[model samples]
Target: MNNNTVDKSVLNTASVKPKVLLDDAPLSKFHIKIAGLTFGAHFTDGYILGIIGFALTILTPQMGLNALWTGLIGASALIGLFIGSLVLGWISDHIGRQKIFVFSFILITVASFLQFFADSAIELVLLRILLGIGLGGDYSVGHTMLAEIAPRKQRGVLLGSFSVIWTVGYVCANIIGIYFADSTNPDIWKWLLASSTIPAIIILLLRIGTPESPRWLESKGRIEEGQAIVSKHLGENIVLDRQEIASDAGFKLLFSRKYIKRTVFNCIFWVTLVIPYFAIYTFLPLILESFGMSSNHSTDFLLNIILLVGAFLGIYFTAKFSRRGFLIWSFVVLAAMLGMLALLPSTMTLLLVAVFGVFTLIMSAVSNLVGVFPAESFPTEIRSSGVGLATSVSRFGSAAGTFLLPLSIANLGIQSSMLILVAVLLVGLVVSVLWAPETKNLTLNRASKD
Candidate 1:
């Protein structure tokens, strides 16, 4: 043996030095797999929320609940969701991502199971409120964790994939509801609601293998641990120190007039995208019925078709195009679809339904992208907070839309209300073109870099 052997022996002196296992590596196929699983877990609540909106329209009438009561009951989950999102996001900033991630899933899983036993409208509302709390946490924390851990180059595509998961959840719920609705058994809706929890359980199980986000770890001053994580996933040795981490000055820096303008702009831009999305998408079944379509299984089947096609294909487009370009097209396409519905005769309703399927696909994809923009805009320390606040505020528009849409249906009719909704989309398209930053090349770290 030579001097080289001695050097190797010195490097392997594990008895004296604790081994630092590398954790953060370059974007790997392995990392993407984990991110995808995380996305699935995050998506369970959104799917359940959307499906319940449609289900309530059918179930409320069946259960002898008034329409306003039905809408109020529908709004209750969102009320819980709004509060939970704000509270959990603030908590996520202080504690860590893992605990909240695990806890939210547990809450959602329990809430879902209870839906099977609900006997009255009041019980259903209470259960949904609990479910909303879980969803509230999931939306903020899930995206934050994924954004912190995902590689910079693929962040847009990966974040966009989270949107895909929500649509996937929606499609799954619709399929289950449509299939079981024809049965003489009244418990089929319960089965549909309960089945969603299975995916949440699967997500919680897979999360066991995930490492804490390196950026989040590093933010807490766990330098050695953070570096090890970076090394493992990146396949490169990364050296980190106090200076290399975000400084106190950087914290103060984001609030300067320059960054403040962008922050407010992004917050508003994201809200615009979400307003029409939640306004129309969440109330899809109600809108469909207003169009004179049979609200029987046919409505659910059509919604499923739109969600499934939109989930996979919209993500594919977002991955292929710039974020701004994809959003512009999504709005324009959706506006045109709604415009056609406004102009078409009642006899062409079937054709309009087909076009509306396409519209749902476009809006679903567009909404997916909207969810990613806020997390991408802020720095690490405030990433989750900024995203959470913006998302929570957007829910106001959603909550407002829930109340407002029914009134619009009663007064404006479906055709006129859709034209108004399309006008909102047109405004979003213009705002996105003017304001939304192209985050295609920035990493979470780089974007947040002071």
Candidate 2:
């Protein structure tokens, strides 16, 4: 008998008594709450990530920020996200999801309010890092919990909504920025940074009675407790899937031969998608101005509006296509759009803006896959671990990109910056063609293991 096991490997030999186990369970209000909670959490995340871009425009001048300070402020939250996801994400898998679920919002809410009082660039940087850490914990566990609770038939739709929900939050932040943007008000950036508190509090309250993932409990050999929660919330008809025994699912397993390929693939999948997205979006106002367009949040508003529309389109396409096919095709279109942006002079204002809008729409549509693949790729025991590591790695890469974009543009110009991002997209496209899995319709078990 092999002793290495993640959760309930004994279930591999046990028979399920119920006809409708978790995978086939009907969608219920409970599931809706799960989805809603995760969505709200992600929405706050997007707002935090997006609001910094707008706030920095004011903070730079008000605080007299140099390029170095500006990059640190821009990348601070991302670097914090990297740490939070790497550390707390692993802890959640070991300690249980519910604790981290409640604790994250507390951190976010507190950090957001603190932003209103940030007087120096360094103080604001520290506050942003704290905010990012809270979001990092949420990012690690929220999607994992959603995937585990959703019906397999609708899991794609539920988990897939993550990216779009995030985009909507980002759009909302941009809208708010446009509305409150006042060069005369040195205090405007403070309010913008503090606004994140609203969503955090709402999500925290909603999370109060949420149940832990039964599958996670079962994996940890707490079968009766797992059964009790499922039966209590989902009724006796719902049960957990049988898990195979005799495999260690420790974090180290992510680098083992069985998972290393997937670990690398998932990391690459996300890192490429977000690196350019964050870098460009974080400084979008400046980028627009560099293109001889309005930097006064008007053009940014239009781009964000397109992103909002693209988010709904993303929901439809995420549910409609194979994961592998959708990913590869999206990257191709993304690269083409960037190529157009790179070659056409920014002097072609309307044409350049139009191309960028098309790019934003396409990017939003396919970004949904990021939510689905990481959760669906790993088995129950290490699901959050895989997701966390992916989030951590991607945030690190994005932090680098966000920190460097200004420097790159200063040295190479905006067109050259777009071309470098184009190359990044091509690399993702190539990797997707080579290794992206077709897990669109598979059961969580099969998706994770086979």
Candidate of highest lDDT: 2
Residue pairs in clash, model 2 = 7-219, 9-245
Model 1: lDDT to the true structure: 0.69
Report the poorest 10 consecutive residues by lDDT, candidate 1: 17-26
| TM-score for each candidate, following the candidate numbering | 0.84, 0.93
**Model 2 C-alpha lDDT per residue in residues 1-450, reported as the tens digit of each score:** 566754575575364455578888889888898899999998999999888877888878878888989999999999989988888888888888888888889999999999999899889889889888888888889988988878888999998888888998998888887777765787989989999999999999989878888888887878788788878777777887776631446688888888887888899989999998888888887677777777655667678778888878888888887888889999999999889988887679989888888998998888888898898888777888889999999999999999999999999998889899999999999888888877776776434553
lDDT of 2 at 187: 92
The reply for model 2, stretches above 4 Å from the true place, is: 1-18, 245-248, 296-298, 446-450
Q: Write down the lDDT that model 2 would get.
A: 0.85
Off by over 4 Å in 1: 1-25, 232-256, 282-285, 292-303, 446-450
As for model 2, its CA RMSD to the true structure in angstroms is 7.8
